[model samples]
Target: MVPKAFEAGYPKTLGFRKVVKATIYVKKKEGMSDEDFIDYYNTKHAQRAAPILQRHGIISYSLTYHLERDRKMIQDIMHGKAQLMDYDAICTFVFPDYLALAKFLYDKDGAALSSDHDNFMDDKLMKMMVGDEYLLIEDGNKVG
Candidate 1:
């Protein structure tokens, strides 16, 4: 998650815009380890997603491996912060507009990318959380 201060400043500097955040938790089924999932994301899934993202209007995105504390935070958010099995990874994206995002979602390339991701990872037991925030910007510059 972005620091609260940074989140707060986003509206002021970048102006008002919409932010879409997605948190994906890949839970191992008994024998699977967190490292295995990370490797799959870094080595296999990321390679496939990169091209699709570029083809779309994705301005930027990041993939992060959660540390122990971060994992705790995820658990906390999901279940009042109680300790739970660590999450596998976190992915975030910043886009220009909802139409662009929608286009990416419904496009053939996007479906292919999603299919590739499903093929590379074990998402049957995965948990995903998504949220959106709209901030009023000072000027139109931020929208662009």
Candidate 2:
């Protein structure tokens, strides 16, 4: 669910507001040596990462793996109204302002997160980060 404030503020901030989404894809190394990557992401990493991001003013986000239905949905969105073409894991952020988002992405914590992921990720894994503008289809979508 989206927060009341975000619902009220989104439209007003539409032109001024900025939303960022990043996708990270993981692949294991040969001989199953990199299986730990999956375990880390599915268990500890996400939980650990969430609080850190929250501290940086990330209003909402989620981590997801690719599924058949997800592929279909992405195809539909790309071919349909929204022309987004690429992404795997989508992390959405609604900051108080654009600068906050920029700062958070460039800050020490953000850098550490990036580095940590890179350090653990196998060379075979294809990781990428892409940014995009988002429309809030619903309010407080991230808050539980």
Report how far off residue 113 is in candidate 1 (Å).
2.9
Candidate 1 residue 81 Cα shift, in angstroms, is 8.6
Residues 1-144 of candidate 1: C-alpha lDDT, one tens digit per residue: 444432421444443344545556654335545676667767777776777777766777688766556766777788865655555566766655555556667878677766655544556766766545455544665443
Q: Model 1 misses residue 34 by how many Å?
A: 3.6
Clashes of each: 3, 6
Model 2, residue 119: displacement in angstroms?
A: 5.2
Candidate 2: minimum summed lDDT over ten consecutive residues — where? 1-10
* Residue-wise C-alpha lDDT for candidate 2, range 1-144, written one tens digit per residue: 444433323454443234544455554333433245456665765666676677767767665554345667877977856544333333344555455556677778666776556544454456655454455444856421
